[model samples]
Target: MSVYVGNLSYQATQDGLTQAFSEYGTVKRVQLPTDRETGRMRGFAFVEMGTDAEEDAAIEALDGAEWMGRDLKVNKAKPREDRGSSQGGWDNRGGSRRY
Candidate 1:
């Protein structure tokens, strides 16, 4: 299981998260997503710990705690939903329409 950390500063780094969470237990991985177009931190991250106990400890301690000048929102990460194809709203097929 992974923990979802939200309300993080744009400047927060993976190393910083690792250091903080490591106090609870071994940190397996840290993922901080970035904006595709701007390449900036998305103000959130996902952290995977060695065990669920570590994740619980981190979540309990970090949730609503101020870190890097922002209140952290820490909790278990829900599985990502599958967003289907990229085809947008417009219909491509040409058809005659009488107004």
Candidate 2:
């Protein structure tokens, strides 16, 4: 099972999330996004689980729990669809470019 964690603090780290969820059950993986340039926390993350029971346990334990001085929002994650860039849309240009 996979879970999505959101509303995280910039100080939150992958290790911190793992440790926090370890109390409930084993954590398969924890992924925290960071700024591309600054390399700082992006304020959100995702967690992978080995079992549904563990996933539930983790969500119940971590959701609404404060971490890094911020309340965590943990929930099941849906598969992400690839979002293309809007610049490729012809509608925005009103037609095809001749040049």
Candidate 3:
């Protein structure tokens, strides 16, 4: 399981996240998504720790805690929902069949 960390500063970096989370336990991975168009940090990250206990500790310690000028939203990362194909739309092309 991974931890979802939100409300991060745009300047937050993978190294910074790793360092912060490492205090709780071993930080296995840190994924900071970037905006496709602008190529900027998305203000959130996913941190995978070595153990569930470490993740729990990080979440409990960081949630609602101020860091990098923002209050963090730390929690368990939820499974990604599958967005099925749009081929079944009204027009069968992902759009409404309007007049």
What would the TM-scores of all predictions be? 0.85, 0.78, 0.87
The Cα error of candidate 3 at residue 63, in Å, is: 0.4
Mind giving the per-residue lDDT tens digits that candidate 1 earns over 3-97? 99999999899999999999999999999999999999999999999999999999999999999999999999999987644654533456433
Displacement of residue 19 (Cα, Å) in model 2 is: 0.6
lDDT of 1 at 65: 94
Question: Which regions of candidate 2 deviate over 4 angstroms?
Answer: 85-99
User: Which runs of model 3 end up more than 4 angstroms from their true locations?
Assistant: 85-99
List, residue by residue over 1-95, the lDDT tens digit for candidate 2: 58999998877778888888778778889988788999888878888877889899889988998877878899998898776454544545588
Question: By descending TM-score, how would the candidates be arranged?
Answer: 3, 1, 2
Give the alpha carbon lDDT tens digit for every residue of 10-60 in model 3: 999999999999999999999999999999988999999999999999999
Better of 1 and 3 by TM-score: 3
lDDT of each: 0.92, 0.82, 0.92
Indicate the TM-score of model 3.
0.87
lDDT of 2: 0.82
